[model samples]
Target: MALLPVDDALQLILADARPIADIEHVPLHEAWGRIVAEPLIAMRDQPPFAASAMDGYAVVAADTAEPGATLRVVGESAAGHGFTGAIGRGETVRIFTGAPVPQGADAILIQENARPLETTMIGVVEPVQAGRFVRRAGLDFHRGETVIAKGAMLDAGRLTLAAAMNLPALPMHRRPRVAILATGDELVPPGADPRDDQIIASNSFGVAAIVKEAGGEPIDLGIAADTLAALNRSIDAAQAAGADILVTLGGASVGDHDLVRKVLESRGLELAFWKIAMRPGKPLMSGRIGPMHVLGLPGNPVSSLVCSHVFLTPLIAKLVGRTHHVQAVDAILDVDLAENDLRQDYLRAAMHRRPDGTLVATPATRQDSSMMRVFAEADGLVVRPPFAPEAKAGDAVRAILLRHI
Candidate 1:
């Protein structure tokens, strides 16, 4: 099949993906990063009653219209111990912040604005308007109102609001479970002794980190040899774990040693599309086995990581009901770039800001897909369109940032 464009490949991958239907009740403390499965209704008014917003005297606003007006201190209202008696004309109640405002009191005369005339009398030096320093009932939210909408991610602010709404727990969507499997006879587990031609496997670790950051649970299926039996065993393990997505590293290309596609097809895998028209990730393959999605990525460390950021992240975000977008912003090129290729390029580049706040991107001299160290030091990927003309320095370009810088 002809290679699919990068955007077209992504569209096909996400077209049928939907948010997880299973909802789990998570405590407010543990709900962070989870997607709300339903609208959160307030159990009661944020403040059950009209309350004081300041430590002051609650009095009739009409009675405190003039300066030096003295009122009898009838009672004290403190948090959790409110004054039950109503305030009459020429009477005031000593009220602390968060205390229920006494009935018949329309305003609060703050302590700084009041002068003590006697033990039971205080002068209103500054007259307070009605409702001043008073937090009306349901000021924050009303009972039975939807305070948090469905599909909202629980962050610090949202969690705090949920707590104040009297919600101790939230209904959240179950995070997607991803199974990672590394393939190839030349690969071994990290820290393991390897033969002359064998290399340590490192792609699964980076892929797992991406999955976690995208709010998906990653299950390591360990490394599988190039043989069909090993691949079939790992695939069985992934299905046993109920993984929503199975990610296979290496053996995606049409070579004699490539067995991922062959094994997946034998197990009833429905092929979607294979190979993208993009550099460092042209061998990318996406398909489905029953209900599980399968993504075959290139063996190169940098290629695997880039594909994860470009594809897997969005798939996980979709399954969790979280909004995800890969933003490519305009930047100035710091060096000349060769052009004209059938495949799109994602050049690892360093980003910096000029004195005038203009962003400048400088791609590394060597952009080999196998070099993991260069990818790590890169701040972003300088995107070059397929078949674009050669460009000189200082030309405006576009980049997808990977780091804060």
Candidate 2:
């Protein structure tokens, strides 16, 4: 099969993937980090009524004159209780923050700007205008207004807004369940003493972590031997567990023992794309088996992780109906780079903010995709296009940030 470019492959994968239709209604507290399935509309106007914004004296604007003018305080209004008396000319009402302004009063003069006098009267230190410090009804939000839109991911701020809008629960897309299967005859589970030819099966753990970070629930299917029967059984178990996405590590290349693609085809999965023009992940494959989307990742540790970031994250986001997508930023290179190979490269790099506020990226000394230590210490990936030439200091480059460095 011909190798497809990174962009083309991604576009193809996304073209067929659709947002999951299954939704679950959860309480507002459990809705955090979940995607809203429907628009959340305000049931009632915020504030509901005109109220005071500070502890002050509510008075008719016409009654508030220049300094030395005194008005009789008719009544006091606190937060829950409101003054029922109508303010006539030369009359004022003592109102605290959030208290409903008295009838006929359009403005409030802060207590600091008023001098309390005997016999329920106070003198205005400064002339006050009408409608000042008054929070009108629906100032924050009006009834029937969309407080949150569908596909919006819930965060702390959004959750608070939903609660304030009287939303006790929300319908959100169900989180996708992902199954990770690691395959290799020479692979052993972590902490197991293995023969000299066997290496710890670490790809499943890393892939599971990536899936979790991407908001999907990962179900580790444990290590599958290189035998065809064992691999098929693992795939069957994952399907029985109701996994929405299945990820198989290793057995994707053209080597004699490589059997992932063959097994998937035999099990009736339609192949989408098998090869991509990406270093450390050229053998990546994606397809659909029954109702589950299956991804075949390269056996290398770094390759599995890179492939997960490139493909799995977006898949999870799409399935969960999230609107926001991951993006890469352009940065200036701080060191030289040699000529690139035919495949696009994702070199592990460290990112830092320079003194002048420009982003600076430096590639790690070791560019081997099999090394996990380098990937652990790296903050992002420096993207190099296929067939590109060497890069010098201060060269503009694109970087996909993993997290804030």
Best by lDDT: 1
Q: What is the lDDT of residue 404 in candidate 2?
A: 87
Predicted structure 1, TM vs. truth: 0.94
Q: Taking the tens digit of each residue's C-alpha lDDT, what string does model 2 give over 160-234?
A: 999989889998888889999998898999889999999999888889988878778899999888788998999
Task: State the lDDT at 8 in candidate 2.
Answer: 89
The 10-residue segment with the lowest total lDDT in model 2 = 318-327
Model 1 residue 64 distance off true place after TM-score fit, in angstroms: 1.0
Q: Tell me the whole-model lDDT of each prediction, alpha carbons only.
A: 0.93, 0.89
Q: Which prediction has the highest TM-score against the true structure?
A: 1
> Pairing residues by index, what is the TM-score of model 2?
0.92
**Each model's TM-score?**
0.94, 0.92
- Clash count of each predicted structure: 0, 0
Candidate 2 error regions (>4 Å): 80-89, 322-324
How far residue 105's Cα lies from its native spot in candidate 2, in Å, is 2.8
What is the per-residue lDDT of model 1 for residues 129-154, given as tens digits with 9 covering 90 to 100?
99899999999999999999999988
